[model samples]
Target: MKKNQEIKKSLAEILELPKDIVLDIPKITMVGNLQLYIENHKGILEYSNTRIRINTKSGVLRVIGKNLLLKSIVVEEMVIVGEIHQVEFTD
Candidate 1:
């Protein structure tokens, strides 16, 4: 698996493609501490006012914050809005 990932990374670089898309990795975008955009997520594992767990290809993404809300959700992406204190990935 590790070898495959390294090959993918090399191909992405050589092809000048976005690594996240080529390697099937999650793309996380943050706007200060107020909003977050997660692309290429598998699903929402957990959700609450102060915590959220999202499943992705690489791992479980944990978001800890205040007044966290799922602003929007779609097949491939999700928008989160709140006081995002911490974002972590757990394998």
Candidate 2:
């Protein structure tokens, strides 16, 4: 496999996620601090600003915070910053 593909595979294995799930794309953008329906959304370990949750097909981006500011939001792109209180994901 190529380097990027290998990396993605490694991440999927590390995350214990199914390959299909790990490759799912986001449908919605900037629900909150979260990117919706993002499958291979790795590399986020610290979420002190705002809580975020994305949905399948990248349809929804849910964010929870005291005062949130979404700098930009698109169907598959988003940015959020603010005082975050809690973050969770729902199925």
Candidate 3:
């Protein structure tokens, strides 16, 4: 019934996520006081100089740093501006 429908919807969402990141437990990626990339993010909750907050259905997160910039964001993709140091992440 209703519960089954909700479960189905949730499963569909899970299926849509990148397989490698499906269980990766979303994290906040910060680049040297210049930018932040919240992996698997649902949405932004709040913001300030020293902190940026986010709220996901699974959890709430807080990022602490300085000169934080929102360089770029895309569907399943993001880029940050820093010393361009040591690119990491595999698809």
Sliding window of 10 residues with minimal summed lDDT for model 3: 82-91
As for candidate 1, its clashing pairs are none
What is the overall TM-score of model 2 with all chains considered together? Answer: 0.39
Quantify all predictions' global Cα lDDT against the true fold: 0.96, 0.50, 0.53
What does the lDDT come to for candidate 3?
0.53
Q: What is the lDDT of candidate 1?
A: 0.96
TM-score of each: 0.93, 0.39, 0.46
Q: How displaced is residue 2 in candidate 1, in Å?
A: 3.6
Q: Taking the tens digit of each residue's C-alpha lDDT, what string does model 2 give over 1-91?
A: 4587678778998999876656554323334433332333322323434455544432344556755554555554555656555545544
Clashing residue pairs in candidate 3 (N, C-alpha, C atoms within 3 angstroms): none
Measured with C-alpha atoms, the lDDT of residue 40 in candidate 1 is 97
Off by over 4 Å in 1: none
Clashes of each: 0, 12, 0
Using lDDT as the yardstick, the better of models 2 and 3 is 3
Candidate 2 steric clashes: 12
Best by lDDT: 1
lDDT of 1 by residue, 6-55 (tens): 99999999999998899998999999999999999999999999999999
